[model samples]
Structures are given as structure tokens and as C-alpha cells.
Target chain A: MGLAKRIIPCLDVDNGRVVKGVQFVDIRDAGDPVEIAKRYDQQGADELTFLDITATHDNRDTIVHVVEAVASQVFIPLTVGGGIRQLADIRRMLNAGADKVGINSAAISNPEFVREAAEKFGSQCIVVAIDAKRVSDQDEADKWEIFTHGGRKPTGIDAVEWAKKMVTYGGGEILLTSMDRDGTKSGFDLALTRAVSQAVNVPVIASGGVGELQDLTDGVKLGEADAVLAASIFHFGEHTVGEAKQQMARQGIEVRL
Target chain B: MRHVAVIDYGMGNLRSVSKALETVSESAEIHITSDPKHILDADHIVFPGVGAMRDCVSELRRLGLDDVIREASQTKPFLGICLGMQALLSYSEENNGVTALDIVPGQVRHFDTQRERSGNDFKVPHMGWNEVRQNISHPLWQKIDDASRFYFVHSFYVDPTDAGVIAGTSRYQHEFSAALSQENVFAVQFHPEKSQSAGLQLLKNFLNWDGQS
Candidate 1:
């Protein structure tokens, strides 16, 4: 009746190469971004997200080349993240063929930057990625706080309220990641996902902890996420994007097959 | 080699559009230009953009492509996408009120965003893939199945005064015009370059299309 729920396979790219694990991607020359991107597109991935994990500033420009190569061939939406702090950085990524550029620490450091970016580029291309973990110790803690530096630093900003503010500042979408369950292989923080999703009118992309196929459906049906993103499962060849769609379809969650 | 001009008015991304055209076009030279001469000299015209309509129209007028677009739509295989499609309307509700190219009698309005009575969570900007039902048969739809899902990421939808020009419709809050056609022009709200197989086919059809009904 409406838009289909999207499945995005995120590739952590460092200096122009996708790296999840050394042994996971040996089949097709492992780290080649173009090859991995092409394979995902062929498997019917709705979109592709390249999280630039490169450390140095000079090496950061490498992601732009990676985005350009993949975007030239793959005809789906491409979003690039990591080290996007200024307007020039956003412009560089967009000009290099990225459909959207994600803002993480920069967005938290200066909230006005979100408004400026939205006013300049339009909110459609601005995505604010939030890393959050539960603050309360009680079972299924209801209170969560924002974390920066990949969940190492806590900002004490309430996750739900921050999501609303980011959207108000003209962020088109929110990439909410549950730091508590990121590598646990358990599932998305459904409680955290629902709280933020209900508080905001924009689309929420659930990230961080997806171990299997059912977790994808749970994020949509239970967590109320507009899209689900994962890296390891798809990167290791445990499941194809096609298979994920079929699984969600079986669960009666609307997906593009 | 056929020359195709992608009108760039300093708004959104034209890189993907040109790249996609280059990928599908057979011996056709794709040129991304804002100049009037390049656009006027081209055999095919592809107008594409994103962002606000006020800026889109202002920039089009600033670059003087408004007249060029109007002129090209009459005698060439012209295609418009996203903000480019909205710019063809008479006016848009964005930025208070902004007048458009007036090629098609229509008004672009922001999504009502009125939560459906059935309790469906319909969001604005309507970002994602949605099914587009073909309202009329057109050459640009060649090799593409009807009601196929296409990538869309816009907050406003077009309402043409003349129903005949509406080539396609898609339901978001309610059914809205997703594609429009007039004589030699075809425009869409969705991004064909980003719609994968279905989108690629639409672009391929446009490249091979002869300016005929």
C-alpha cells in the first residue's frame, strides 16, 4: 500500500577497500569495494552504505574515489559516512557521486551544523547517525543516552529527544545504532528503536546488531524501523540480499522482491 | 553519436544521471551542461535535480535554462526528473509560493502528512521504493512492467490540471501524479537513475525514443 521497507548492506571501507574480516571475503578478492558493491547490487540490495573507517585525514579522500567508482556502475542509492564535519566535506562526497552523506560526531559536537547543512543541501541528503546505549540499569532499561567516538564517549543526551531534535534541524533520516548489542549478535535494541521511531516523523534505520534473518523482520515489525542495516551477515556470505527479502516477505513485512 | 544534454542549474546531483545515461547509451554523447547553447544543440534533453523548488526555479531562471527547457520540450525527446518535473508546474507551495516553468498546468504541494485513518505510518519526503501505476501508455515505459516499484525521495507531489498529461500515478497519502507527458516531453517524480533495473530500462527507452507520441 506504501513504500517497501529497505534492506541496506553496509560495507566498512578503509582507504578504498571494504573490510569486515580477513577470512570472510576471500571468495571474490575480499576487499575490493567495486566487486563487493556490484555483488550486492546484483543480489537486489535496495541501497548500499559505505562507512569510511579510514583513520588519517589524508587517507580520508580515498572514500570519495570508492564512492565514485561504485556509484558509476551501481544504479542504487549510495550513502557515505565517517569524518564528515564541514559543508565542504559533504559537497565533496555528493559531487563524487554519493546520494547522501552521514554525519555522526560532527552532528553531536555542533547541533547548528545540522540546520546549516539542511538549509544548504536540503534535508533529503542529510542523515544523522546516532550511537546510543541504555542508561538505566533496570531490565529493558527505558532511558538511553547518545554516545560518540563509536560508543566510547557518552554525551548524556537522551536518545529519543536527540532524534526528534535532529529531524527538527532538518535531518531527513536517523541511523540509530544500539551500542549495547552492536557486536553481541543478539538483535536490535527494539525498545530503543521504538522509542526513537515513535518520537520522530522521519524514517529510522535500525543498525548495530543483526545476526540472522529473523532479526531483520523483528526490527520492522517490532522496532518499527523503516529500514534495516547490517554488515557481517551479508559480508561473510551467510545470506544474500535476495534471501533476506524473501525471509521478510514470508514474515508478511513488505519488501521489494 | 547523439548528443544528450543534462540541464544543471546548481541544485542537486547530476553526476549519477549523466553516469547512468553513459552506462546505457549506445554511442550517444552525454553532456551535463548549464549553458543554453549546449542544451539547444543537443538531440535529447534530460532535466534532473533535487532540493527546494524555489532555489530550483530561481537557479533555472538565473542560468536562463527556463526558456531553454520550454523551447526544447516542444521539439525534442525531453525528460524531466524530481525537482525538474516539479519545475514544469505552474507554481509550487514550497518557500511560501514559487512560480515554475508553466510548461504543464499544475501545482506542486507538500505532502499532507495526515496520518491515514487506518493507522498506517506514512512519512513525508516519501523516501524509498513505491509502485508506480501507469495511467497511459507511453514510449518511455518500453520494456518496463506496469506497477513496478521505482525509487522516490521527495516531499511534494504534482497535481496537473489536465488529467491526460498524467502518465503515471502512485499512492503515498493518496494517489498522486508520478509521471507526466505532453507532446514531446516526459517527466517523473521518481529518480530512474537510482531505481536499479526498472529505472535503467526507463533511461534506455528515453535514449532510443524518437520525439513522437
Candidate 2:
């Protein structure tokens, strides 16, 4: 059958607790990762992503434990990102119960690592996360530059070109996040998302700036993204995963409703 | 409690598969191991695989688990996922062609890159959730709905020489075997572990199955 569009709820965890302060019903006092993950699984989330914002050696073990605890209960594929630099780190994440590891800054520092990781672990598990922003300079009219270190440092590299190169280097999926629209609640940068999605043969997950259910639908429809990833919208309880899936399903976009 | 052993050939993600099986059944003890004896002794055997073919085949050969798997599939309730399912076929086109176990008398075929349906492009690795249509009744499918969506991330699919063994079909560029059953052995191309509720139901069914059909 035709592949269904996915609605992914991103959880940004700092240290041990969810950084966004996502509260689980009754279990709010516990703040247990497993409990929160179980809630999402029951809500019919196509997938769940855990971004360890701490990304420090001190918190790596804690995050690994979190991954293990959540993975043991949640039946969906879980992707863990942040602080993943080398093959050993990727191995640690995978062995710690992550289905896929999203690599961003490390990929920029050394693109060869992408090829190496993809070679060791299948391409299906290597996700290259690209944070991009529109370049408004006179030099380039239609250009988006890549950013690193949590969208603080801007790299002169063209976003679309880098995406194509990542695919060539064997990256299985691209998590394209529009930094300009990230927390704006305006919606996904459809132009940016569409450009990257068209450039890569692998699945593209559009992240950032999802305010409502329609934004999730737009990610698949206008942006041509295979999946949509939002943090604040899902984490803050602004909307439920079921509501997003239902909206997509009503729009004739195949979602796990 | 029933003991279920998931064969680990040092490839793919076994954590999700093992955990999902654990979540589905409280009566079954799931173990992920490469040891042949443990695999052979389990009440049920699951062969989960991913990554490249050459590496997968080589690891299976290195561990000598191929023989163990062959022996186990003949007697106990056996289940295979993705590359695990592909390895059962006679041959696979991945990695410029590699020899497989030939358990199901079939060839693993790659999706045509140039093929696209309704003008929409057909991407390889087929990574996403897709609807699976049940073609025949099987123990593993008990309590699961007819057209449930399951997560899949694979490029090549099995083309069994004997269609009678095909238990389920899913459309990508065209219809392909989503699940295959032969006697006591059942295998699927999609990751039931990542398929949510329907998947949990299928795994629960497997836990309770007697390996008769």
C-alpha cells in the first residue's frame, strides 16, 4: 500500500528531565521518561524523537538510561539525537535502545563520518539533522545557509546542496529544521522543506514551527515532507498526537490514525 | 513461561524487537542472543536482520547460526523480520547479489528506482509506515485488523517462487509480500515492533500461538 505520512513528537530532554517541561497526567509528579513515552505510544504517534540538549559527557549516561527505560515500554521507533559525534557514540545510542541516531554538528565537522557511520550501521539508521535559515543577502536571493551548535553558528554551505551531498554520502534520512521559523509558530518553511525533500531521495522529516494541526498536514502536502517533527506544540500540550493524525487523515494524507 | 530467543547476527536493531515482544506478552521470556543452543532451545525463535547483505550473510556464517536457524525453523515456531525475511530467500540482489538460506524458495528483488505510481516518485529503502493487507488467515494475525499500518525501511522485497506461502501483501510500486508463512515458520518484511497497537496485537498473538499453522 502507499506509505503513510508520519507525525513525530519531539522531546527535548536536558539532563534527565524533559527540557520543555512536558507533564504527564497524574504522573506529573514522577516525571518519568517511560511514563511520558508510554502516553505518546498510546496516543498513536507514528514515532517519537528524543533530543538530548545537554549533549554533555556528564549527561550521556543519564540519557542512555532514559532511552533504555522508554524503549523498553514504547513500541514505536525512537530516534535519539544531540551529543552524537563518533561511531562509538552512535553505537552507544543504538545499544542503549535507540532505533536511529540523529547527527548534526558532527556531520558538519566531518562529512566522512556520515559515510563511515552509514557503512558500519545501515543507512536506514543514520539520520542527518540540518538546521537551516534563509539567506537574505544580496549575493544570493534563493539560498538557505546551514547552522550548527544548536543554530548558533552559521556555515556558508548551501542547505539544499548539503542535503544532496549528505544523501550521496549514504545518509538515510534528513531532518530539515527551519531555524527562522522554528519557534515562530507560523508553520514549516514549505519552500525550504520542499527544496530539501526534492533534492534527496531519502525520506525528509520537516521539523520546527508547527503551531496547529494544519501545519502538520502542510508538512506532507505543500512541503512534501514524509514526516513532521514538532517539540513545543506536542510537548507543551498545545495539541495531542491523535488530533494531528486525524487532521492529516481528513486531508487525505495517510497517517496512523 | 515460554522462552523466545531473538537471533542476533550483529546487525540491525534488536532492542526494539525484543522490547516490543516483551511489551506484548508477560508470559514469554524474550532473550537476544547469538548462541545457537539458546536459539535452538527456545520455545520460539525470531530472526531479525538489517544492514548490508554481505555483512549479514558473513556474520550468520561466522556464527554458524545459519545451520542453527535452519534446524530451528524446521521444528519450532519461527519468525523473521526484514533482512531476516530476505535471508530466507534463495538469493538477494543487494550488495551486487549475495546467496541466502533458500528456505522459502524465492529471490529477493530490489524495487525499481525508475518506477513511480500516479506520477509520485518511488523512493528506495521504502522508509515509512504503510498499510498491510492480510491475504490469508494465520495465527500471528489473530486479533489484528485487516488493513493495519506497519513501519517499513527496506529496499529489496521477497518474490517467493511459491505464492501459496504468501500470507499478506502491501503495495509500494506494486503489491509485495508483507508477511510469509510456511508451516510453523512465519516472517514479515515490516517491523511489527514499530507499528504501534496493531503490531503489539500481532506479537501478542505470536506469544500465544502453538506453531500449528
Candidate 3:
């Protein structure tokens, strides 16, 4: 009995409603985050993450209400990401019941914010979300660069080096997402995950490009991630968190099943 | 009327703690306070902390809650969590060695993943759910299976000088003290507030406990 690899289901919420398709399974009112969060909790999900993909300024406050409603009922750790720019945003999300906040573009713009946030709120709650994209193709040498603005904007910082720097700045966890495989169902960037995981001592969460149960297992076995986060497969009712854990357990990965 | 005061010394989130406790019982009053006077008035005190030991120590002294915690833990059902649990020890290796409350005779040591064999892909912060082997029977373990998994996130583990106080032990790079109990005070390395059903059950038992082993 040892530490089990965590299976996290990420919800991309837009304007307070879950922004994903509900065409897969028995889900009523796909926009209601509380109902979906409750369902995931019942499925024995290790943790739940809600990314506020909401863009409009007027609807920005909607995610807070959604977070507050979900936090009251769900007992596990909750993480809220997307648009976390300032320390006040972190406090607001935490006060609204989020256990951790993910900082993306803000960290790239001002690395000192990470150090300040970690000093104020502790590194356990400060997560540096790194969006990594391959700088070279499959046949060439493995190299990745940091991407921002939903993986649309590119930064010159090397993904591996940036991860190390973030950890130095008190980023307790690294949420590494492969821009190349994010929505393609191709699988996680194992090489990139390994590079970052090996370079730092903090927990690295492997996100993006999870197509099937095998991909989740590969994330832990190959990527060496402390946790695996997926959006589509689980959100669309194609697979449940319980089923994913079982699949990982069957593959000899220790999971809380 | 039972009241639980979750000590807030300018660190981490205390709402989840208060919220978890509130969910355990509606009749009991739960509030997060940095005031020592209000803390001592409560029936039970939950010391919840996160962040560096140096900061935790500095804040406790700055707010004069160190003495309050010592006094409160001696008489009531006091619960120390995460950084708070580490603070109960004499000192820690973090921040290049920081002196702690010295309540539980022990020295907090780092995981030292770089030096250890760490053949098992051992990582720092030891984050996530792991089985906690029960070393002694206690009220908090009520309705919870022995060796049950609890959520944890810390880089250091407690090494109590007095083995008798150890209630549970878990292994990462090596087996270390995961739970400690001395008189009326009980501390855990894991975040029971985030441990789900087993965690809530422990809190429920604490609400009903009378500080008697």
C-alpha cells in the first residue's frame, strides 16, 4: 500500500457552464457544473479541476459562484485555473473553496509573482501551469517551448528549463500540457513530461491528449507523472474516473480503487 | 454548544477546514480565528497551517498564538494538520533549520530523495493518497479501516523522539511518523480535511470526542 497515482478530470467551464459537448452519455443540463462535479465525486475521482475558459468580462464572476456551489458539496481537493493573474484571484478562488490555483501567462510575464504568491499562500496551493509545444518534429531532436494564450502564443523559454525555474520560484506543482497532443487524442508528450519530471522534485501533472485508458496508464508509466488530467474522454462520458483507475490498476499502477 | 476554532495565523486556507467541520455537525459552531482570546474560548481548537516552517514559526510568535496553542492543546481536543503537525515537533530541517514549538519531542527531517535509494520513483512533497498503517488505536480512527489511504502533501516528515506517541506511520522513501498523539493533542501529516469520507469521519469522531484516550 503506497501512494497511488492520481486521476484528475478537468472541466473546461465557459461563462459558468461546462463548455464541452454532452453528446456522449446520460447527462442532463451539461452547463450545471455542480451536477457534473457531484457525479465525478461519486465516481471516486481523486481530484477535480475547473478551468474558467470564460472570456467575457461580465461573465467572469460566474466561475466563482460555480466554484462556491461545488466546494460546499465536494469534499476532495479542488483546483481552479484559467485567468488567474493576480494574488487576489488566488485568494478569491481559495476563499470560494478551491484548494489550488493554476498560474499560466502571468508567471511568464512576471516570474516574481510566483515567488510572492508562494510566500503568501504557500507553494502547496501555487501551481505553475506550463503549456508546452514541440519546437522540433518527431524525427528531429526532442525540444519543447512554452506557449501562452491557449497555446497560440509562443515564448522563447525552453519548456524544461522554465519548469526548473518555476520550481525554484516556489511552484509546488507543474501542470504540463502538451500543445501538440492536447485535443488530438494522440497521447501525452512522454519525452516532455519525462524531461520536466526528471528536472524537478515537485509533483508534475501530465495533461492533454488522453484518448483511451491506455493513455492514462502511459502517462504514469512513461511520463512518470504524479497525476494525469484529461478533459474530453471523461467529460463526454466515454470513460469514468473509476474505469480509468481500474484500467491503471490492472496495468500494475497503484491507484486508489 | 460545541465550538471549533481553526487557528488562522496568516497561512493557507482555513475555510475548507471550517467548512469541513461545519459539514460534520450543524449544531457545533465552527469559526476560523487568529485571535488567541477567541481561540481559547472555543471547546476544540484545530491548528491548520501550510507553508514554510520558518514563516509558520514567525507568524505564531507575531500573533502570540504559540502560547495559546500550547495551552489549548493541553486541555481540549486539539488537532494539528500538515505544517501545524510539523510545528509541534522540536525543530525542522526546512529553511536551513527552524526551531518549532517543541511540544512533541522530535526533529522534523527532509525526505532526502536525492540521497536515498528512491528506487520507487519517490518524489518530494509526497503528494497524494497513501496507506497509513495504524500503530495504535485512537478515537480518530473510528469507523475507518486500518491502513486506509489519506491525502497528503508535504516535503518533510516527523520523527518523534518518543515512539509511544506515534499512532500511524507511512512510507515514501522511508517509513516516517504520519500521526502523533500525546495526552489531549493529536496531529497528522496528511490533510484530513481533504481526505474525503475517511477524513470527514475522523472529523466527526473529533466533534464527538471528549479529549480522553
The candidate that wins on TM-score is 1
Per-residue CA lDDT of model 3 for A1-257, tens digit only, reads 68889999999899888887743356677778988988888888989999998888788899999988898888899999988888899889988888899999999999999999988888888889999999987699889999887788898889999999999999989999999999999899898998888888889999989999899999999988889999888877888889999899998999887
Native contact fraction, candidates in order: 0.73, 0.77, 0.66
The sequence of per-residue lDDT tens digits that candidate 1 reaches over residues B5-86 is 9998888889999999999998899999999999999999999999998888888888888899999998899999999899
What are the per-residue Cα lDDT tens digits for candidate 2 across B118-156? 234477778888888999988899888888888898989
Clashing pairs in 3: none
* Per-candidate TM-score against the hidden true structure: 0.98, 0.96, 0.96
Candidate 2, residue B91: Cα displacement in angstroms equals 0.2
Question: What TM-scores does chain A show, candidate by candidate in order?
Answer: 0.97, 0.95, 0.97
True contacts kept of 2: 0.77
By DockQ, is 1 or 3 better?
1
Question: What TM-score would you give candidate 2 relative to the actual structure?
Answer: 0.96
lDDT of 1 by residue, A153-205 (tens): 89989999999999999999999999999988899999899888888778899
iRMS of each prediction:
1.5, 1.8, 1.7
RMSD of 2: 1.8
Off by over 4 Å in 3: A22-28, B116-118
Q: Please tell me which model should have the higher TM-score, number 1 or number 2.
A: 1
